[model samples]
Target: MSLVNQQIQLVSRPMGEPTHDNFKLVEVPVPELQDGQVLVKHLWLSLDPYMRGRMNDGKSYAQPQPLDEVMIGGTAGEVVASKHPDYAPGDPVVGMGGWQLYSVVDGGQRGMMRKVDTTHVPLSHYLGAVGMPGVTAWVGLNHIIAPKAGETMVISAATGAVGSAFGALAKARGCRAVGIAGGPEKCAYAVNELGFDACIDYKAHPDLKSLSKALKDACPDGVDGYFENVGGMIMDAVMLRMNAFGRIAVCGMIAGYNGQPLPMANPALILVSRLKVQGFIVSEHMELWPAALKELGTLVGTGKLRPRESIAEGLAAAPEAFFGLLKGRNFGKQLVKLA
Candidate 1:
């Protein structure tokens, strides 16, 4: 067993917004692995916007990250030592390994970890499209939003991991996919690179009313499905233009993640349109992941699904990168690469 572990912890609960002081990077001794436990050296760490909710001290679908505890996250790493027969040295796997260079994981806590064939696809891809983000998109689209062929679909945070995956899946299913991103570059990437039917730049079009009009114009058929990643005004705008019997999959609320309080939506519109909105955490839908992963992997391997990742070079840059993600500064799947 190792004597030291370098890790990041939550120093203070953020109020309006998180600052650098909210996180503290500290080195402590690694705990010894017990029977049926394995030690993993993390290679790739995923940074998703939903993590913001876990920082707050409140009851939600999942437990909040406790103050002064290691920040929780998903990571891809190789087992270095194992008392668990299921995992062994050099086996690449992914699970809830928190924000650390190394972790001692109990066998029971490991869910999705399996030896991977990195020769076929990059190991990091397991943390993105073929992993949580992909499953999030799949379940939201298929089970929740349920977009029909030739219907109009729109997604907020369109250049991000989950949002982009949603847009691509919508397009693949014969729906017209429209994306709302932060900037022109991201908009361009959404349409040109990601093959979205159209894209709206939220930064360029600051007026929610105008944005709503543009979205309505883009989808003359009316928005049949909305994959909501960024909430707040975007939700308001989309709700105004939603067609009858529209479905909304509430995947994230990145717009309010940086400490802003979300305004109440107009309930009248929901009543009038009979909109079906369902919020879900990926952890709750773990039962569907194996099937979702197989489908997503097929799409990626066959070139039907494309994932764009915004990678930060070192573990030290994760905090800044995460802050950028909350501000819509990242272009794709935000990840911190560990050496």
Candidate 2:
């Protein structure tokens, strides 16, 4: 007899926006481990904005998650059984285990799985602040933007996993962090909880002119750096506020995922503005994660980076939770608690 595992699979590619009908929940028997494999029982599943791009069968940085397969996702769980020498039962590890209750990893594959320390930081934080999202912030701020002290840095989706981490990381470098979120509550959290200098509610400003003015008021000295997550009008608005020679790290342009992408506005002329813009995929730069993870873990352990989480109760709730994530319905890191 084998373990029966519950998992979510993407049944169809989304046309405009994804719906519940696009996903299928099914149970399958966990496969027997090969000589070099280990079995992991997932405890948490991470749902991110990037997953949206993976759902479409289009040209992108990474391949489509693959139809009829387990919906791809990051997971933090314990190795329940192991045939590999490096991993033993009870080892806490993190990997791309998809949306499943169990995962079998070929321990021979490097970077496929990593054993993490949950003594200081909770295992769940590894999915958000202390994990990929945290590293994204570090890479963008340190590697690309590299803002100087007293400079102002603005980020869209400011209360999200990446945005929240970006604020604390920028502040550590003595940069004034400003965030633009959808509503007043999110703005308040960005300022008060995330330690951002100020936050602008994009919802309050319906048009591009209003959003730009709000950014102008929030960042009086002009924006020295921008960590772009939500693009489109947000990018246009932020572009108008960018100072000459400012740096922009385009991590996600989710504003264009479901439909036709938004065209850049006139203010985004890098030649005249002399702005340095770079779009990056963090997975491609694995060499930086060691240093980035160290700093993020310290921030959380020291109570400096208090990452908030919104956890859906079970595996079945992942799809709905993910939809909420794309719609800006979840605050902080969106996750599904599996076990």
The residue-level lDDT of candidate 2 at 178 comes to 96
Model 1 C-alpha lDDT per residue in residues 202-267, reported as the tens digit of each score: 776677888888787777788899989988888898999899999999988877776678885687
Q: Given candidate 1, what's the lDDT at residue 143?
A: 92
Full-model lDDT for every candidate: 0.85, 0.93
- Writing each residue's lDDT as its tens digit, candidate 2 over 204-295 gives 99999999999999999999999999889999999898899999999998888788668888753687789999999999899999999999
Model 1 clash count equals 0
| Count of clashes, each model | 0, 0
Candidate 1 TM-score, true structure as reference: 0.95
lDDT agreement of model 2 with the native: 0.93
Clashing pairs in 1: none
> What TM-score does prediction 2 earn?
0.98
Q: Please give the distance, in angstroms, between residue 41's alpha carbon in candidate 1 and its true position after superposition.
A: 0.4
